[model samples]
Target: MTAPDPAGEAAAALGADRALRAAARHSAGRLTALSVSSVAAAGAALAEPALLGHTLDLLLRQDPAGARWTGWCAAVIAAEVLLDAATARLTGGVDARSTARLRRLGLGRLLRTAPHHAARHSPGELSARLTTHATAAGGVPAAAVSAAVALLPPLGGLVALFLVDVWTALAFLAGLPLLAILLRTFARASGASVSRYQEVQLAMAGRLVEVLAGARTIAAAGTAEREQARVLERLPELGAEGRRTWRIYGATMARTSALMPLLLYVVLGVGGIRLAAGALGVGGLLAAVRYAGLAAGVGAVTGRLAAVVRGRSAARRTAVLFGLPELAQGDARLPEDGPGTLELRGVRVVRAGTVLLHDIDLRVPGGTTAAVVGRSGSGKTTLAAVAGRLTACDGGRVLLDGVPLEDLSAEELRREVGHAFERPALFGEDVAAAIAFGGGPPPGAPAVRAAARAAGADDFVRRLPRGYGTALRDAPVSGGELQRLGLARAFCRAGRLLVLDDAMSSLDTLTAREVERALLRDVRPGTRLVIAHRVSSAARADLVVWLDAGRVRATGTHTELWRDPAYRAVFGDAADPDREAAGRARAEPSSRPDPGAVLPSVPEPPGREAVR
Candidate 1:
C-alpha cells in the first residue's frame, strides 16, 4: 500500500538531493518527456467526452458532413497511439536510470567498509541486494508515475462533470470515502506483508547459496534429501504467506469491484433521467456520464496497482543496504612514513564480557621478524589480528610508523600494511590477478611470474593452459595453491608491515619453509608478525613470542627463552640451546627491555611461518 498522496513524496524523494543529484538532474529531461507523454494520454481521455458529445449533437441536428466527424474520430485514435508509444519510451528511460542509481549506491557503500567486511556477508545476499532489490526499485518509479498520472484522468474528468451537472458529480463524490478507506487499508496491510516476504526471500536465498556451495558435501553425506526437506520446510510458510496475501486482495477486490460499477450506474442513471426530462442538456448528460465512468475506472486500475505497491514495499525494506543516511568514503590521507614501528600497548580484547586477551604489550622494530607461537585458543591469531587491525580491541592501541592504527586512513593502512589471511579470499579473478591482488599496481607478466616463483606457485601455474592468464576464479582451486597466491601477491608492495595471519597454514612443511625464506630474503623489508604453529618456523625468528591463554607468557630471542619452562613447553626443544643455556647458567638476574626503546627487534630480516 502506498502513502496517501505518496506520488508527491515519491517523486520528490526520488528527485535530486543525493550524490546522484547530477545524474538525477540529467535524467530530468527524460522524466519531463515522460510527464509530457502522460499528460498527452490524459488529454486524449479527457477529449473523448467532448468529441463524443460533439459528434452526437452534430449528427442529431443533421449539421455535420460525414468526413468532419470521421476526421475528428481518427485524430482521437492517432493521439491515443502516439501518447502510448511516447509514454513507454520515456518511462523506460526513467526506469533504467533509477535502477542504475540504486545499484551504484549499494556497491559504493560496500566499497567504504573495512576490507574484510564484504567477506563477512553472504555473497548471495549481497548479490540480491544489488540485483533483486534494485530490479524492484526500477518498477517503483514507473508504477508510481503511472499511479500519479492515473489520478489526472479521474480528477480532470470530474472537473468537466462538475461544470456539466453538479448533481451527478455529487454521486461520484459519494464513493470517495469508501475508495479512500479501501486503498489506505490495502497499502498498510500489504506493505507490512511485503516487508516480511522480502526478509523470507533473503533467508531462502541464503539457504539456496549454502545448498549450492555444499552440494558436494551434502551428496557425499547422502543428506540431499534432508537438505532439500529443509528448503521445502520454509516453502510452506512462503506459500502460506503468498496465499494469505492473495486471499486478502481477492476479498478486497470482490467488494470494491461490485461497489464501483454500482456507483457508476447511480450517477449515470440519475443524470440521464434529468437530461431526458429537460432538467439537464443532452451534451451535459453524455459528458457527465463519461466522466463518471472514468472516475469509477480508478478503482479497477488501482486494484491491480496494489501488487506493484507490495513489490516496491518489499524492495524498500532493504533500502538500508544502499539508501543509508551516510555513504562510506574514507577521508584520511595515507601516512607519509613507512612501516617504521608497530607497537601494541596494554591491549586487551574481550567478547561478551569474557576477556580474550589481557595486557599484551609488544613491539616490532622495522624490518625484523617475530614468530608468535601458541597452542589453539591461545590468542596467537588474535594478537596478530590486533597488528593487522582486523578486529577492534577493548583497550590499547596498535600503531604503524608511530601513528595510532585507528587514526590512519584505511587507504594508507592497506597500502602500507599488507596482510594475508590464512584462509585468504581470492575473488572471481584470474590466477595472476589474484596473486597480484592488493599488490601496489597492476602487474606485468614478468613481475607476476617472479612473485609466483618466490611463493612457489609458478611451476604449477605454468602447467595451466593459459599460465599467468589462466582463470582461477571460484571454479575450484586447492587450499595450498590459494595460500601461495596470497603469498605471491604480498611481494607486489614494499616498505610495509607484512602481517601473515596463519598465512602458510595450508602449505606443506617444505613449501611453507621455502615461502617464508623467500619473503624474508626477497620480499619487502618491513617488520613481520609471523604467527605459526610449528616450532621449526620459529627457530630462525630474531625474537620469539610465546603466547598462552591470550597473554604474552614470554618474549625473548629464541636462544634466550629456550630454558624458560613455559616457553620450552610451547616451543619445545626447538628454542636455541646456546643462548638459553648461558642465560640459565648466568647467576645474575636479567632486566626486561624497555617497551618504548630497544634495538627494535631488527634482525637480519630472518622470518618464520605465517599465522596458522
Candidate 2:
C-alpha cells in the first residue's frame, strides 16, 4: 500500500460515517425490531436468576408456592431462548437489506459520474468495495444495535446485585475499570490492524486484476512467472496484518478470561459473609451471587465491539466511491431540424494539472464532416471527447446548434449525440442486439441489417454460426470487426451529431475507404467529427482541423494545408506514399461520388432516426 494521506483518510472517515447512518435509516424498521427483541431477551435473562433463586428459597422453606415459582422460572428461560432466536433472524434481514442498499447507492453514483472519475479505481478494487466492503458496512447497523443492547445485561445485573447486597455489588464494581481498559485498548488496536489488512487486500486484488487483464501479453512475452511474483509481493504484509488483528482479540479475551473468575470469587466470598452475618437470606445470597456473575460478564460485549470496528473500517473504503462527483445535467432540449451545427468556443481541457486541449475554437457546418488530425499526443481524442460531452471542458463552452451542450437534458443530449471509440465495449445478448444497443429503443431487423451493411460488418456477421442471433460470447471478433460493429451501433442510432475517435484505425486501407464512403452515403445526414490518423480520411473531409501540442495549429481544407511540411510530417514517412496519392487524388476529385447525393431513405427507428 502507498503512504496514507492523513487528510484524505480523515475526510473519507467522515463520509463513511454519513453513509453508515444512511444505511441504518434505510433499515430502521427492522433494526428497531431487533433492538426490541434484544432488550426483551436481556429482560428475560435478568429475571430468570431472581425467579429461580426465589423458587429455591420456597422449596427450602417447604412452601406450597415453590412449584408455581419453578414454572415461572422455566417460562422466563423459554422466553429468553425464543427472543434470542428472533433477534438472530432480524439481524440477518437487516444485514441483507442494508448491504443491498449500499451496493445500489454506490453503483448508481458510479454510473452517474464522469467516466474519467470512475476510472480512478481499478476493477478489482471496485469489486472489493462493492462486494466485501459493502457486506462489512452493511452489518454495522445490526452490530451497533447488538453492542448497545449488550450493555443492558451487565448494567441490569449490577443493579440487581446492589438490591440484594451492597457488598456483592461493590466486589463486581471493582473489576469495572480493568474491563473498560481492556475494551478500549482492543478497539484502538483492532481498528488500526483491520484497516491495514483491508488496504493490503485491496492492493493485492488490484494487482491480480491488472495481471489478469494483461495475461495474454505476459504469456506471449514469457514473463508470466515475473508477473505472478509481482502480484503476490504484498502477501506477507497481508498475513502480518491479519495475525495482528487476531492477536489483539486473543489477548483481550485472555485477560477477560483471567479476570472474570477472580471477581466472581470475590463476590461469592462477600455474599457468603453477608449470609453468615444474617444480613441476607439463603435465597437473597443465591440471587446476589448470580447477579454478580452477570455484572462481571461485561467482557461479552468485546466481540460485538470488535465487529463494529471491522465494519466501520470497511465502510471507509466503500465510502470513497460516494465522493465521486456526478456530472450535472440540465432540462433544455435541442431545436427541431437545426442541421446539427457544432461549435467549440474557447474550449480548454485540463487533467492532473496538464493541459490536454487549450484555446480550441472550431465550427462544423450543418450536414458536413470535419476531420481532426494531429500527432499521437496532440489532443485529437480530447477534442472529440469534449465535442461529445464525454468529459466537460475545464474552460469555455461547446454548443450543438446554438445551445450550450451542458444546457441539454441528459436524454436529449444522448439521443442527439452519438460516439464510437476505437475499442467499443459491446453489451447485449447477440450480435444484432449489440448493434441495435444505443440511447433509443432497439431498432427493427431491417434497420439493424442496414447499419451492419453500412459499417461493412454484414458479411462477417452473416458467417457466424447463428448469424445476427449469435451470442456475443460465442462470436469471437477480430479488432477490425469489433471496430465495424462499434460503428454499426453508432449508425443504428444516427443522430444530429456523430463523433468517431479513430474508429477506423483498425481496418485495412480498402475496408477503411469503403466504410468512409458508406458513412456519408448510407448514414443519416449530420455533422461528423472524425479524429483521424490517416491521410485519406483528412483528404475526404470538407474541412480539416490540425491540432499541435494542445492548440489548433491550422484550419482549412486538406489540399489547402498540404503545402506545410510540418503538416505533412504529422503522418510520418510510413504514410508518405498514401499522403502523396491522397493529395493528387483530392486535387482531381471529380471521380468520387457527388458530396450532395442523397440515398433512398430507410424507415426511421422509433425515438431516433435510422441509417438510410
lDDT of each: 0.71, 0.88
**Tens digits of lDDT, candidate 2, 191-262:** 999999999999899989999999899999999999999999999999999999999999999999889999
Q: Which 10 consecutive residues of model 2 have the lowest summed lDDT?
A: 597-606
TM-score of each: 0.82, 0.93
Q: lDDT at 84 for candidate 1?
A: 90
Which candidate's lDDT is highest? 2
CA shift of 161, model 1, Å: 1.8
lDDT of 2: 0.88
> Candidate 1's residue-wise lDDT over 1-612, tens digit each?
445557743643353224234334546787777878888898898888877776776777787564597579679978989899989888778778876876777677676544444655576677776788666765565666678788888888788878778889888889878887887777777766665666677677777887999999998999998998876667877777777777767777876788888888989888988887887877667878888887776776555477466646545533545443231224455456454567888899885567879988877776667889887889888788778776667799877777777776666767777777788777536887777666346767777777788889888887777777778753356899888878777765444688888888889777877887888766756787889765556656666777889988777765566566766667444435423433453434533332222323433342334311
Assess candidate 2 and give its TM-score to the true structure. 0.93
- Candidate that would win on TM-score: 2
